[model samples]
Target: MTRSVYVTSIERGDGRQIVELGVMELLTRRVDRVGVFRPLVHDGPDRLFDLLRSRYRLTQDPATGYGMSYDEASTVQAEEGTDELVSRLVDRFHALARDYEAVLVLGTDYAGSQLPEELALNARLANEFGAAVLPVVGGRGQSAESVHTEARNAHRAYAQLGCEIPALFVNRVTPADREEVRDQLAAHLPVPCYVLPDEPALAAPTVAQIAQALQGTVLLGDDAGLARDALDFVFGGAMLPNLLKALTPGCVVITPGDRADLVVGALAAHSAGNPPIAGVLLTLGERPGKEILALADRLAPGTPVISVAGTSFPTATQLFTLEGRLSAATPRKVETALGLFEQCTATGELLDQISAPRSTRITPMMFQHQLLERARADRRHVVLPEGTEERVLHAAEVLLRRGVCDLSLLGPVDSIRKKAADLGIDLGRARLVDPTTSELRDDFAARYAELRAHKGVTLDLAHDVVADANYFGTLMVEQGLADGMVSGSVHSTAATIRPAFEIIKTATPKAGPGTAAGGEPAAAPIVSSVFFMCLADRVLVYGDCAVNPDPGARQLADIALQSAATAERFGVEPRIALLSYSTGTSGAGADVDKVREATELARARRPDLPIEGPIQYDAAVDPVVAATKLPGSAVAGRATVLIFPDLNTGNNTYKAVQRSAGAFAVGPVLQGLRKPVNDLSRGALVGDIVHTVAITAIQAQEPG
Candidate 1:
């Protein structure tokens, strides 16, 4: 009878940090149970709020094994004639509300003419304690008329206790008034509206932290690596080319260049050899432009650069008035201050279920991602490109009109029915191609003479590049007709890796001179190609950006078994690290003996790999420098899958850690192809080509 949900938060200083970050982020989006009960003592004492609630243990409710009953009365001293302190807080929280199933009662700073008289004494204690009255408003200049008087006092005291559901928390807001308080309480709140997100994570900003937070000067404009720990909030005052046309790159924040032509045109369009600019904050003294320090020394040579000198709105108002003593942030600025540590360091289950907002999930609609919900539940297909076949035919007619996917499109059936009747699109029973017919020009001249049969094709040059309607778009993905294929707009990732290495290669084959994260692997069998890199729940896979340039250490043990079989085909357990410049048995070149021979030949070809390496990228991602230097190396300190050793150190260390590693580099995500094929970077970013066509439509049924 207790699936668990006992939450009792109504705040002032500690409504247990936004009820332990919205009941462990709504029990990681709907129930596996969640806990956290008492910790309220504000009129300045309950032994100093039970000594800061026993410094963070919060009495108890660690899901099911319940906790919290710190009484010490005066919740704003009887807010509206307190029925004996609201019947002793519903008799000590209804004796732990008859051992839980759902108890979310929140409302601490409860008053201001007693919020409809303390929501009618928290609705006779959620109806004499069965429990479910959510209201937690906790202030800081709230107003939408104090969130429409706490949603008309939790809808007239839960419709005089008949019951309704809608918990509201605006909590100290001001990231430009959170979508106007979610556009005036999203059609006036019924329940579920948590808004936390302005954390800056401090520590590395001195002059006694920029004279106690204001007026800048930490100059060292990193190509974009600028002291690599990424999350860019660069808001240089109005029309600095409207803050470089409000930048759109992973975790970008670069506006305070004091408008030296929009800070040297957003440091020559984002730095690091030119593409890196995650940190180069020159507000009023706007420095760094000897071509952004020679493109940050040809991108990331001595990266970490900071320089602040005020005037970018009093240095973003002394960084939101020292955003609560700056929680030491720097791992590319953890989402630049995850809204003040989502009420102080994400708690319990992982709180996220306010039903899809701004849409970005990648996984968890109850543990999904088996190649994206099994190529969207077995109905696969999705292609689109004839001028983005009307934006993948309106995302494949809304994923086959909501049954969710089985549509394709290449071109010329009368320019895709006059561009889907001039974009009023309807391809209802979809599936079309015409690459100027004749059985699609003999399947685009046998996939362009099987990718230029070693560069000498001529049946009139494979009928002039398979009749150039863009080589029937890589011959609708080498004639499977299309389970997956989302080409780089006008083509060139060497025209999408020469027809997937002459029509789909790698079923698992590679040897001698293969693994090229930088280069020198493969005495044989280390075939390379990677990109998995999800982002939402944090995935990571990376290897030879999209195919080798210099691979060795037994072709980096077949590019760490194709990046740990595409991070266990996306459920992710692959820890592999390999990146070098030394960690274990410290430095000694031949490029740290080719990342300690590709970490003992990828732990002797995947001997249950959680592989490590010559290491150091801060000891493979800093878990306190992998517990002070490789303590029991389970892949150094929790590496998700880094593996570079060549391809100019994996395409300039993933475009200089995708403009200085703050976070959000979804991919060059190609992986060892047989089915999914991707490559778009000439002007990539129609949201990285709609997440590279949703990672080539979740590799339409992967078996190839």
Candidate 2:
């Protein structure tokens, strides 16, 4: 079966942009079998129509067809000589309606604009045909009041003409007016209203909605119903004033005024008519300050405020686990909270069951203080590089003032702090350093001048090199100041890697230019990956994820070595599973041959690797199946580190298991680099950025 939507512009308005986006968002969720039919699409290059066609392409099965008979030719051609264009309009819409499940009739212009009669005719035809008529309103320089009034009147006209419960979509609304319009629309109209967020990104559940879907409770107030849509957290002491200013009509939890200051800032933000915050949550054992009380009295008036006496972190933890909004009875709320906590625990247990194969073979008792000695001696030093990104830098500042790690930042001092302030990134305990601000500026200048002096790098340029924070930070790892360095925020892959290759190429060659696998191999570092699949206390290791695209015989051996090395660092015993197309090499091909060679290589590289390979995907992991397939293969059934042959197989396989099997992947976490140099996709999200930062820091640890 094919699903198609026919969009008609009532007048020559720009509602099509939103008409297209909303439809696409709906399609991603609701429709699977999709096709498109544009009834009477106007001719001569209609960009809006063209853009709609582009969006439709992404939602449908990539291999379907699209028809544009309606839009390409005016309705006049379909029903000529009756009402001139009106006859054809009804005929075309009716024709498309018969073909598609739901036809979205988009009202383009107002009744007053060109062809108001034609607009009315189209609306009536839409009613007669039983289509979903959505008023998509847009104005380049028009007033919001006028556009809104126009939309409302259109809805009234459609209803009076015997249309079904119709909806109005306010298009290209100024972000500031969106909430207000929604508020106003709710009271006057008698229909379901869905506000499209002000973003072009493909729609998914809202973050708030996502939280709600997780079946969690809102924490700020006692009345869980109020916290469903959390605006922000309010710090205790200084929050009252700011709470009044910035509370975003959701739940606000306050702690000390230090925390209160955040609340005040949030409340002051709401204006003569901004979205008012939901409520206030007073946390910890602190009383509200005078300023806070005054502000709260005036700003909130009778808004409900909940008080809980617990530490801020604990308070947040409770709030997060509550499974958003509890307007229900107390007993019901308690059950929901307990259930959610248990669910989280169960997710944690799943993680604990996955262990590294043979990782417990060697356990050391003594601890070393110096990272240099630890890294070289232990072969696994967990390092955490102090970061300069907004969240990290703030955390770094906290750590520095508080003394957290041997820190390194990637830019000039003044610039870093300025950017940090602009972004409101907390410095936490981080010690800020300008690689360019060190005492060895001249020494760096002299050295860099000698190395790349001919690359147009004058003595002055050399000074800049010594002064460059990222360059200096990478140098720390190269010169053994830190065991490893993870950095890429202020630099590129090329810039981050060049310094390391120049200063610390490798103690020995990696298995090869790429990855090492196979039965034949001398001991060497090979490509591997480590993913910290975190489930509360269940932090398991998954490898060959970050490095080694596809393995040949030799590369597989290297993957084992690297995988084993990473597992040891994270304290998980290594259990290797060499996955294959067919178990026991029942199939013959270059792939099986590669897996066989790789298994042979692993036995040689890490003699106690506890590895099993040339095994089918099921036999390699399922104990019940493994017991039958390879009777005595130790790693067959309980493999944690799944080694794949190539990226086409590994990348797709991991993602599927992650989504289908309810698993999470942490990193291809770039492993086997001379120094830590990871690449971020052009459009990585903030969470991705956070994980990468942690990985880099852990890599900086000395071998011990």
TM-score of each: 0.30, 0.42
lDDT assessment of candidate 2: 0.48
Leading candidate by lDDT = 1
Tens digit of per-residue lDDT, candidate 1, span 654-680: 677666754445557666666676776
RMSD of 2: 22.2
Q: Residue 219 of candidate 1: its Cα lDDT?
A: 49
- In terms of lDDT, the poorest run of 10 residues in model 2 is 363-372
lDDT of 2 by residue, 541-590 (tens): 55555445666677676666676666666555667777788887577889
In terms of lDDT, the poorest run of 10 residues in model 1 is 349-358
Show model 1 residue runs off by greater than 4 Å: 1-182, 186-365, 369-408, 411-433, 437-455, 459-461, 464-471, 475-499, 503-560, 563-565, 575-600, 604-608, 611-670, 673-675, 678-704
